[model samples]
Target chain A: MRPPPKSWPPTKGSEPLPNAPRIAPPVSAARPAGKLRGARALSGPLPWLLPALIMLGLFYLYPIAEALRLAFTDARLFDQATEPSLDSIRRVSQSAALPVILQNTLVYTVASVLGQLGLGMAIAILVVRAERARLRGTMALRTLVLAAWVIPAIANGVIWQLLFSEAPFGAINSALRMVGFAPVAWLSDPSNAMLSAVIATIWQGTAYSMILLYAALKSIDPALNEAAAIDNATGFERFWFITLPHLRAALLVNAILILIMTLNMFDTILSLTGGGPGRATEVLSLFAYNTVFQSFELGRGAVLSILLLIISLTLTAAMVVFLPRERK
Target chain B: MTFRAIPAAFALLATTAPVWAEDLITRNRVGPADAPNALTFRLTAFDLYSADPATAAHFGDLFTDFILAHPGWRIDTQLQTGAIAQEQARIIEQTRAGRGPDCAMIDSSQLATFKEAGLLAPMTPFFTQEQIDDLFPFVREGVTDANGDIAALWWFTDLRVLYRDVTLVPEPPQTWADLQQAAEVVAAQGLEGILFNAGRDEASAFDWLAHFWAQGGELVDDTGRPVFFEGENREKFLSAVAFFADLVESGAAPRRVTALSSYDDLLASAVAGSTGMFIGGNWMYNQIQITMPPEQAANWAVSELPGPTPEQRATGTGGWTIAALTDDPAKTEICAGIAQLYAGPGNAFQGLLPTSVSLFEEFETFAGPEFDVFVSALQNGRARPSVPIYPEISNQIQILLGNVLSGSMTAEAALDEAAAEVMAAYERL
Candidate 1:
């Protein structure tokens, strides 16, 4: 059996001489040198990515590895006698407050994610579907929404705490009293503390979801909508079949990001509740922090942190597997 | 050989000359008639001390006056905090490398660690015997190193008190039984009787320690060994714990008292009218005055912490101490002199306390009536156990007490467990 022709540089002569080795012409020719040069220029900035990767490895990866190691060691601030053991892990598992903390964390995360996403989607659709004549003021309104996102998390917590203060002097309580209602202890009551935190977090986080969904909504082809309309399809029908699918990728991305952010929420909770009202609003992050700083149980605190990391990683992995991957 | 010998001779002279001069300077500096020459001194203020401009100014004035009296001395002061922990770590690292601070205002607890590490200089030579006698005995005991040498001087004192609303309770409770009865009345009127630090942390331990001590319970024996498990003291402590548990469970105290992680939390609860009384210290008076309205502030008053038995009345006194950290004998003496000036009677150290004995004699006023209770409490205060393993012991007490109060463990069982843990820590120490 003869081997197939080699695809390489073409032969010098066109005519075949006696017993000339069979050679095939190049199947597809290269592009012009300018095109190649343009591609090279585009790839030139890729080297800058190395520094960013190195930073992530140092600041993010190294600390996480260290935390995992510390979690398994008997590390405490003052107590020198405690040997490393599974005691902390056992304590965490058997903790009476564990179930409640887990429940509260999940509830806060899910509720905030759904509430923010729904609200953000509605606002995004409104702004996109608005007539051109009204889009000017609508754009300004979007900017105002973005401003809420711009406030730092700690500052947001402070503002909400002031607003929710139980005293009659508080802004919300004062307003409630003016309307002939009794003042409510927003922070001191366990029933209200978690809900208060959720509201504050959602208020700040919804803008983020809105921006992503809005960008996705704007990118949907108008021609498809026009075609749907000509076929007597209603606005709702167009959104359901055409626009909704277009936003599926963005929604999944936004949901996963929001879930991770909410799961790791600490600053706002620390400033507002400090896991107060008898640990009613305690989340995993705050639990980990108190274990270390307040109790000086570094090993136990590290264990909690490791658990949080595992949960975050598992959820991220699930998102990757379950969400529809975007096609090129 | 001649050149090398010349360098060696000069080096020996150079080193020995300073030694003789230092000895001569020290001898002359302490003479009755001749005053020491002015020395340059540097001091650093902790963030908490520098929080208020007036407080900082007063400290500055006191230091300047001391320098003015000592003709050869000039004082330099720096205000710092964020780098405090790092600076402390660096000091230890440097000491291991053979260097450290001249003087530092260290927490009384940290003094134990430093003393154990053999990094502190004894201040007996710097302070005269009469001056030492004038110091509070409890403060003197707390500042003494294991070798019986005075290693530091106490700058300020803190003590616990039971603060109540005068309009609501009229007279504050003075005994444990009275407090329980008053708590019932307060609860009946729809207000919390007392706010306890039930959080599982150091504050919780400190709060509970006051109660435990008030019941005549000693966490450790005279020999500095754990003895919380056996004898009448254990029963008395458990009885107090039972009373506290009853108070919390009967809805007298806030049901969520376990969530009170900070003094600010208690203050907020009191200001919100959820609580009518709280166990706090002199610090809370200033905080309350700041957060409460004038009318509300007027309604508040303080009294000595209630005792388990009338004879068992006791308050724990703990505070910051200033210690010299340098190896140089002359510099250490100068730093000690500076500490003496700050902590000396009738000086700015009195200002550090809102109701010190000196403050009472000089100002003839307290920050408020709330502070009077603190003054009395301080007058009758017993110092907290000065064991080096205090942090670990405190943690065990807090966890055990919290569990007992929460009904997860019986008082006897909790005490046994805590005693065991404390003994383990003591052994390690």
Candidate 2:
């Protein structure tokens, strides 16, 4: 209004229009020479990483390579006549139980991952939404969940075994009988043993998944929710679009971790079943263990372990490829 | 941290080192210089014995007393439980690594394997001929290697006996036919006739072998091949399986019989008063005493296992053995000495009968009325054939028998299949 805000070009080396806010010229868009120098100075100590690299090579890389080599050869711990042969692989391929073991392993891994994720997410959301007065109790409950994870796997198996013992003297059977229900054989029966092991594993593993997902859920920006609400987005939509997208990285990390853990699971299976009742619940890991330790067919056992590793790595790589990367 | 904290952290370890060193030195010393105080020797047993604290404690005390009476020996003890395969592997590895214990308790059947591995030293060098001659033929033969070396000293001998409830039957059966009739009688009265483990493993195989042997079946013919399913033995064994199958089908025994993998679980059923009869070893006496009330315990009595014929009154005898693993002859000698003292007649409190024929007479007085059944059974018992391939052969038999008992296969078919498997395994060896 006052002379149209002095619409004129600035004089050379003179301060621009007084009424207009002075706009700093665009930075060259390149870092300063001093900053580049400083970055080079900061990176000078990176050569110290060599020792740790060497240690990893010796302890981890060498063993893994040796195991891979052994997997291709026949190596019996007790039988000296067992020479290097591909017979172990052929045996594994011809195993009648191979298909069933693979199916069970996959079912266990998927069920465990999904169950842990869903339950963990719900708990994390509630804890975040809970009022200050109720927060302390929720925190205590979370700690209790974590405590189960801290127990040794063998001890966990024994405790569960007592709970699910087939005899009337067992805790679960006694409780069921008191309720006027016929006692169910929780462990001896083939149908119930695998399920019982899964329940035990879930009781111990859910805490690990929950802690990671909770951190991811809490780190999402509240402003995004407000903005979405301003646009009249429904709560479900906001969660699907904003919350879930934010948690993508955490979920992928947790899934891979859970997959590795479930694939390598041994202690609980060993303590619970010992691959008994005519091998009703023999997982691949336990099968390998029996071949190595019990039967002393070390070469065959090594081959089975290598196959397991390959399967696990393949699954992990697929997960990494399919999962979405976080936005910058 | 200050230097004071470092010493404090190691205080307990520092003080205990000298005491342990002193004990080791004293334990190694023989003759007059040996410590008269009770010296603790750790023994690992199969899970069955190690699970009972009373048995372990009783055995420990027995050895302690025996050692105290000697001039330069003492007995102290610890017990560990592990699977047979696992324990054998661990001991073998330890011996090969040159870090084996001075002494260990092993299953009698493992004597051959131990000797073949060269892990066990001959005990004849340590004991006088009179001492070796004093042992029973069954015990002595069971622990001797192919080379005639006494590799182990028998302690607690396990012999099978038929346990029955007196309330169910006025008089126990005296023959196999009588037993079958008694089973039918018991079943009609709404009670289980007999309980035996039939799980496809070593235990099941052993149980079947006892019946097979009782039926005049030979484990190995002169050709060294298992005659388990051949000729007359085949018919007798199949007849036994048919009898069991009839009981299972007729609801005399539970369908879960095949699932009862462990001896303890089978014993538990008896203790719960669910079954009227069971086949078990001497240790079952202690188990029944602990698990059953005094009144029920009174009703239970042990009798010899009835055979197909009167002359076939044979039962399988097995037991634990103490063997040495040290290269130092002196250490080996001391270990053998400790074992002898523990296994001597005066050490009857250990819950193990003496293997020495002369020593057994001294402990006969301790048999008590309850032990009369076992003492009588031991008179006619035969040790299982001690062979290196025993475990594998037994496992195959178990699977076949389990299939027959579960009605998954015919008795003849099961026997034939098992025979083939055993032959194959033998050939491999």
Candidate 3:
């Protein structure tokens, strides 16, 4: 009788075997405590991260919130009056120097960021190639590139200031005299003040970009270069295709960071130009500082600070949105 | 066995009779490292040590002598250095916290601010009426509160005067026209003919106010109202702006003159021979001597600032004052004594003028020949308006002058704007 039917087991189970291994109904897809498995796992890490969160809340978010709140008040450092108003914002908006300050800030941000990026990328590539070629003293050369980054920005500013001074003993003027060219008022002339500040800033900030780019370059697999070389690609073509594609993430991040740094820079300009030659180099940061500490117009300064924060945040958001995404 | 023996020995000692049998040793009561009674005086000034070593040393000596005289009281002096504005801010913070020095060296310009902040103690309690009256009227006014009580002690004074290179100008300019003519001649000689503190700060205002006063401008009237917007004051403000603007426009002064923020900058320009003339304080004489070669120093001389007319000559008298910040009468008296010694007569500042009229003769003898010009300047000079809003007023003047000098605005337009802004600031105050 068993050999009589080849389809003894029906294609569809019309009937179940009573003695077959009883399996419990598939466990209900429910998470404990009505939470995802990893959701509650954050608690283990939360204690470890509490300090950093507290620090950011206190030092970063707190100041920003306070500044925003103050932007609506007519606050003075020494005044006891606490009248809440938008007069400061209105006053800042109507200021005549506001246009010039914005222009300078824009020019400075563009020039310095571009300068740093261009120089940083070039130097990073060169150093990477030098190392690949086993060139002697490449390490020393790289370290030299990092020198400006190691020195404090204010000290760097002062050094550049001395070099750019209109004084006869200034390094730039002395060099010009040696070359029989007329000494240029590097810092004193309105035309040159912002340019001088940009140059000083680039000198200091290039190292940061270079460092990031260099690390990115090193992370790039050398096998890609080898493959390109085998395909008869030139150095430029290899870098354009293989190296650059890998560096997109680093380049975008570095650009954002440098842009923010340049926008917020205050002490360097304070020490170097003092926003002088008729406020020629007075960026928003300097203007905010002057309004707050120097002029003691706290509310006006807060207004400027809020504007700066908004600009920075907008730019950051734009960059994050528009920049190419990294491969998963 | 050892524990039992130790307890027995301790018990024997504890049971010993006459615990106070040994004569109690008498010694001087313990005190701080300083003498039993010590006074710590804190002073904040621009340059207590490096700016003028002799004066700083004299102060140290005076404190030393005071300690020597007062047998029980040891004197302790703590000096901090920074811009006078910064010092004033620090003093304000310290006083508000009730932890400031017993006294602070306040700038004459800072008196109004300190008084308004209620940081100053009236000097009437510590100083005699005769002594208060003996100060120069402007000096007295600088340290006097709204109620006409002396709020601080004025000791040494400074007057803004015209500094010139003797080789370029054999005689100081007697009028604004003379100054212009001299500047033109000096400019023709391929030198920056003039360097005023055309900087966009209080220095510019301080320098321009001399010209403003000469042109008969008043920052605030006797009734403490801003009157710069009308009549003679408006005209004078306009004229002063035009004069400064002309210096920059005509290339008589360096276009870089717009960058000179401090008298120190002018002094440097003078010492470097880059400027043929400048307006600065008499304190520059010592700085010139300290910073310049003998020949270079000799080439520079100071005179009373030129006026619109010889009869209309004016200068600015500014100085530092010692404001008593302590509530303790004893501390206040001690601070007053130190302030008097530092700024009072017979200290022989040696080119620095004393603020007291009573000390003029004695100061003149030690102040040397250059101080004669300073004396004339002091006699003719007026203190800037000691209103709480003076800093704001001064800043507006600086902005106006800076705008004119930079060709951003015409003198008439700039002064009009400045006058309006100043009145607004006054109203706010």
| lDDT to native, each model | 0.69, 0.68, 0.76
Q: Is candidate 1 or candidate 3 better by DockQ?
A: 3
Docking band of candidate 2: incorrect
At residue B370, candidate 1 shows an lDDT of: 47
Name the regions of candidate 3 deviating beyond 4 angstroms. A1-43, A130-158, A167-174, A177-188, A322-328, B1-42, B45-58, B67-84, B97-100, B223-225, B345-351, B363-365, B416-424
For all predictions, the C-alpha RMSD in Å is 10.9, 10.7, 10.2
How much of the true contact map at the interface does candidate 2 reproduce, as a fraction? 0.14
Candidate 3 colliding pairs:
none
- Chain B TM-scores per candidate, in order, are 0.79, 0.82, 0.86
- Candidate 2 lDDT, tens digit per residue, A188-268? 455566677777777778888888888887788888988999999998999899998898888888889987887788777
Locate the minimum summed-lDDT window of 10 residues in model 2 chain A.
Answer: A2-11
- Residue A217 of model 2: what lDDT? 79
Specify the highest-lDDT model's number. Answer: 3
Whose DockQ is higher: candidate 2's or candidate 3's? 3
- Structural similarity to truth (TM-score) of each candidate: 0.70, 0.76, 0.83
TM-score of chain A of 2: 0.79
Please write out the lDDT profile of model 3 over residues B1-429, one tens digit for every residue: 698899899788875432223211112111123356655555653333435666655554554566455545544556665545656666677777777767777778777777887777776788888888788888877787878877888867888888899999879999988998899889898787887876656767887888888877888888778887688887887888777777777877776666667676677667778778988888887888889999888888888989889989888888777778877776677778877777753246445578876676755464478866777678887887887668767766766666677666677776676666555545445
| Sort by TM-score, top down from the best | 3, 2, 1
**Tens-place lDDT digits, model 1, residues B176-284:** 7888788878888877778877654456667767777776687778877767677877786787678778887776775455545467767877788766788876678
